[model samples]
Target: MPRDGSATRERILETAERLVIDNGFAATSVDRVIAESHSSKGSFFHHFASKNDLARALVERYAAADVAHLHAALEHARAATDDPAKRVVAFLSYFENDADAIMSAQSSCLYVSILTERDLVLDGTSGQIEEAVVAWRDGFAELLRAALPGRTPAGVDIDVDALSDHVFVTFEGAFLLCRSTGDSGHMHRQLTVLRHLMEALLGAVAATPPRRRRAGTPSRH
Candidate 1:
């Protein structure tokens, strides 16, 4: 039987990704991944030249997944509302929901979490992370831009690019705060605040936030 080369590589990547995310990249050694993955040095080297290369691949994968998830959520929002402002609001809700879902799944994005792990954030990988962040802001900005057909709403001077940055940066901050505060619901709270602010800016009615179900009740998500 032929050795499953792809499976071997995938196991190495998956094992390393989990380790690097749990521990800082610089701290997670190649031997740790090789030991945990039950793969030999040859197998690990075949897939990745060095620890840095492996981390870079992980960041690229993380960035691609983030972009795909954002696009899917925004598409859902677009379908739910005809008003551009309303759609932007819906995007926030969806983004928050996705964050919650990610939390529940015990998954994290290397790029978003990389900002704090200074020791492990290599320049080559940081480039990919930065690009991913910029893409997120641009994607968000597009939603805001779509809200207007021509002129800005009367007296509503929204610098589209700035607003985009505001939304992404705020969410990133909220996420970090949520982690630090040990509050799972903090993400939703931040989104609600953002929704209110956006509604005020666009003169759109605020959307109702999701209600909390009693304990043992299933989430509808």
Candidate 2:
């Protein structure tokens, strides 16, 4: 059986997550969290040493959930097609609707918010969070590489890492723009641009022929 203290701690964390999502870090105070969770100061302190600690936990939880969703989307795309271009389109399209909801709900990019608060979050345990971000990027890169295979434009190498970074930056920028403008239309336009760029990249990769394997090298097949 779980202790009452554990239940109270869970309640506090849940309330904190919602408040942070709805109100942001600066606006959501310990007092607000207490009021929302109906938790006492002693209970809050017992679960979290400080607001920063609670913020860190919130970031970790958010990152984990986001990564899981991303993985599921990528897997669904992967299972649906053998063509790399189609897979890329399917993967990016998964976020088309999600981007709008995310912007509308938070009025800010949660990951971006966490990143901007790195100084506060980096008391000592940012490594895992950093890895989570990198892993998310790498996941996208891997999907792109699998979809494109050895197809590369003549004298123009396709850098999967660079492509992944570009996509990530564009996505972050789109969220910021939407929040700044308080308009969903801006985010929709940005996603359209993102889709266009992805399509162009996939087309370029598909148009190129596979590089020749080295002599005596055995193919995976």
lDDT values, one for every candidate: 0.69, 0.67
lDDT of 2 by residue, 1-221 (tens): 68768788778877887786556778789999999899899889987899888877777766776677667657756875677777777666656545545554455545555555656556754655677668767988887778665555567778778787666676677766766776757765776678778777667322222223233321100
Q: Please report, as a residue range, the 10-residue window in candidate 2 with the lowest summed lDDT.
A: 212-221
Off by over 4 Å in 2: 1-7, 21-27, 149-152, 204-221
True lDDT of residue 111, candidate 2: 57
TM-score of 2: 0.78
Candidate 1: 10-residue stretch with minimal lDDT: 212-221
User: What's the lDDT for residue 164 in model 2?
Assistant: 74
**Candidate 1, after superposition: displacement of residue 148 in Å?**
4.9
Candidate 1 wrong stretches, greater than 4 Å: 1-4, 106-108, 112-123, 148-156, 206-221
Error of 1 at 19 (Å): 2.3
Alpha-carbon shift of residue 210 in model 2 (angstroms): 31
- For model 1 the TM-score comes to 0.79
**Candidate 1's C-alpha lDDT?**
0.69
Question: By lDDT, who's the top model here?
Answer: 1
